[model samples]
Target: MTKLVKPVIDQVWLLRWWHRHQAQRLNREADAIRNGLLQDLFAVRRQLELLPGSGGLAAVEHLYQALDALGNRLSSPYLHDSLPLAIQQALADWPPQVPTRAELPSHWPAEPVEHTLLLLAVLNHLGQALAAQPSLPQVCAVSLTAGSDGQRLTIAANYASAVPPALLELDQSEAWRAYLATFDLFSQGRASSAHGATTLRWAFVW
Candidate 1:
């Protein structure tokens, strides 16, 4: 096994940790804003009701619509309550041709937010790779299984031929190396890609 230098591992770990922390903080802030705006809109609507004027209430309704649309545009719910939902949310932006099929046992354990972020990064990387393929495969399979030790994730690209060049580049890139090191730091995990398949297994130490 090729060992990563301690300093490199620490740097990668810190970067990932900082990213997740900022993302979570931003999500909280956005949620607070959305909630506060909704409350203010409700109060405005109630006040408009007493004015006996349709124009005021209509304008308030327009503001409500705008706020709702803006909330949807912002990626605030970065982490979801369940692994499946998180995975689904991550895959929502992926190319439709390389859609993912996630399999999990009933009531799958919710992973830590950091772990979930890592997993989402991995999935996003794969999605980009698959989208770059010359002839995209129709199905990408992702399965999660749990054992006494921890959780294991298996992703099969199911390419008709050997692994795509785009996918190989992503797997071997320096950026991905840092991400892998961060995963190792958090979960004592290891990742491997063979042919068109990728696997990640890590203990739930956190």
Candidate 2:
């Protein structure tokens, strides 16, 4: 009877040790995630400070959208879904006054939730750019194209007139560039005159 009791005690001790070890590992991972969230918050705040006076309202709205996205990401860190569908949903959510025409493929490979959120941020910036135009056209067009390799995506927004220099300045800022670089995304913008109109073009690849 004494020998049997010793084995049982040893089994219980091993089980408790394993549980403690797993708890410690999970705690470490949680701490790392918390630190990341804090860093993102700081970056958003810095971006807000860089906005011009005319863009104050738009910047505030962008910050709120980012916070909402982060909250959703925190709740479900590993979400995977289609990127095209996400962009469509964002376009649908836009205010009725802003007429937008979107051209997106029916389907594409799904990506991590955080990636989708970052793409949404880019879309928000484009929308703000369209809004900043002194006289918005009857319709603005947004087109998205994906590379054959499935490793690259492009978003283009065509505005009726040249976008405000102040709005473009935000996109050219060091903070904005760094934020996109942190996610391994690259972007560039150009302005061209054709016929009698100017078009602001921005290209993003990841």
Candidate 3:
């Protein structure tokens, strides 16, 4: 009876040790995952800060040239007579075959040429990002909503399925960095993702 009792006690002790070991290992793994997530978040924020908005002065120069050309055309009596045509010609061209579609205001408020160009760059980059991920759903949806006073812009991208890994990887790529730099003026912005969608919300004094 004494010998049998010793074996039973040993077995219980071994089981308890194994359980504790597994719990510790799981805790370590959870901590590692949390640390990794925090690191990625900080990295993204740093990248955003370093990116040159609108390609810095060079992009500004190009925008000015475009505005100048448009101004010259508008100065002409024939072109000035047709304001709508002039405005349409001055605006940026939309891309072809983007799976994601944008819902913008019926009439975008008049903004400075530089601001318009920046907005166009953001849209172009978003389209390119979606195009790069073939695994994305056939019909992704993008919507841009402006505040009542036009002081803010909310850009949302909703996916029919989970966002592809490749698309998420773009956040660390050089091309994405360059594209983000063009939004330097929009420093006060926040981005978030959940439930197969991502949203960028930006606020400006304007």
Give every collision pair in model 2.
none
Candidate 1 global Cα RMSD: 8.0
Q: Report the Cα RMSD per candidate.
A: 8.0, 16.7, 23.0
Model 2 worst lDDT window (10 residues): 186-195
Candidate 1, 43-132: lDDT as tens digits: 889888888645878878988888765653343254556776766676776777776777866677756666676777777776886787
lDDT on C-alpha atoms for all candidate structures = 0.66, 0.54, 0.45
Alpha carbon lDDT at 65, candidate 3: 52
Candidate 2 lDDT (Cα, 0 to 1): 0.54
| lDDT for each residue of candidate 3 in 98-195, tens digit (9 for 90 to 100) | 44444444554444333433444455566566655666445544444566653444444445455566666665577656545534423324333333
Pick the winner on TM-score between candidates 1 and 2.
Answer: 1
Could you give the candidate ranking by lDDT, starting with the highest?
Answer: 1, 2, 3
Candidate 3, residue 178: lDDT? 57
